[model samples]
Target: MQIDSTNICERLCNKSIRDISWLLNIPRSTVSGIITKWKQLGTTATQSPSGRPRHMTERGQRMLKRTVRRSRQLSAESIAKDLQTPCGLQNSTTTVRRELHGMGSHGREAASKLYITKCNALDAMV
Candidate 1:
C-alpha cells in the first residue's frame, strides 16, 4: 500500500473516517473507500470482527413475494414449501418470514406479479 494509504489506514483503525479526514486533511469518502477495499481484500484495516451473512437476494425477494401473492392465505411454512419446487429456495419458515419482513411485505398484501427492473434496484441502492 502507498504511504499515504497506510497512514490513512492507521488513522482509520483508531478513529472514524470523519475524524481522520478532518485531522489528516483528506476526504472522508476517500478514507472510507480505502478501508472498504482493504477489508474486501482480506486485509482488515477497520471493521467488526464477524457477523451473519445476508440470506436473501433480490431475485429471492421477488420470488417470495410472488409465492405469497399466489397463495394469499398460506402460512410461512407452506410458502417455503411452494418456493422449494419453483425456485429452489429452501429456508426455515422463520428465515422466510424474516426475509419477507425485511422486504417490507410481511403479511400485508396479496402475492402479485412484482418485477425488479435494474434501474429501479439501482435507484433504490444508491
Candidate 2:
C-alpha cells in the first residue's frame, strides 16, 4: 500500500503546509496543492488528459491487414488506393506504409527460389 501526500497532510492534523513539506521532504507548493485539491475536490487523484483522436479507426486497421494479407506484392500506394473505397477513408502511401510497418509487415516481395537438379549442375559444368 502506497501512502500519498494527501493522506500524510490529513494525518498531520493542524500542521502547516510548510511543516508538512519539511517533515515529508516534499516541496511546499506540492504539499499546498494536495491539501487544496483535497479541500476542493475531496480527492487527490490526477485527471485524465485529453488528446487528439486517431486518423484511422480499428475497422480501418483490420481492413488494411486483410488487404495486405490478400496481396503481399502490393505497394503502399496501391494498398492505400484499395483501402480508400472499402475503409471509406483516404490515406497517403506513407500512412499506409507506416501502418503496415506497425503491423509487423515489411511489405517486401517473396524471395525467388533457384532450382538446381543434378542434371542441371552437370550441364552447367559442361
Candidate 3:
C-alpha cells in the first residue's frame, strides 16, 4: 500500500508537524494539510476535478464514424457539411478533422494504381 502523509501522521501521532516533516522528508505545510484534511473529511482521498464538457456527444461521434465508413474518400469539409445537413451537427471542418484524428481516422484514402507490371527483365539481370 501507498505510504501517504496521513499514514506518517498516524504513526507519529504525538510528534509535531515539523518533526513528522523531518522524519518523512515532506514539507511541514503539506504534512499539516494532509493531517487537517484527514481530521475534517475523515479521508485522505482527492476529489474529482471539474472541467468543461465535450463539444461532440457519443451519438454524434457514432454518426460521424458511420458517415466516414460509408464514404472513405470524403474530405474534412465535405464531412462537416454532411454532419450539419443529415446528421444535424454543426461543427467546423477543423473540429471534424480533430474528431476524426481522435477516432484514429485521418480521412485519407490509399492511392489507386492504373497499371500493374508482371516482371522487370532489367531488374532480374541486375
* lDDT, model 2: 0.79
lDDT of every predicted structure (CA atoms): 0.76, 0.79, 0.79
How do the residues 57-90 of candidate 3 rate in per-residue lDDT, one tens digit apiece? 8988999999999988889898889989876888
lDDT, candidate 2, 29-97, per-residue tens = 877777777778877788777797767788888999998889788888888899888657888888888
Question: RMSD in angstroms, candidate 2?
Answer: 6.1
> Model 2 segments beyond 4 Å from truth?
1-39, 42-51, 111-126
Q: Which runs of model 3 end up more than 4 angstroms from their true locations?
A: 1-32, 42-51, 85-87, 107-115, 121-126
Per-model TM-score, in order, reads: 0.46, 0.55, 0.55
What is the C-alpha lDDT profile of model 1 across 44-99, one tens digit per residue? 35566688876776788888888777876889888888778877877789989898
Which residue pairs overlap in candidate 3's backbone?
A: none
Off by over 4 Å in 1: 1-50, 108-126
TM-score of 2: 0.55
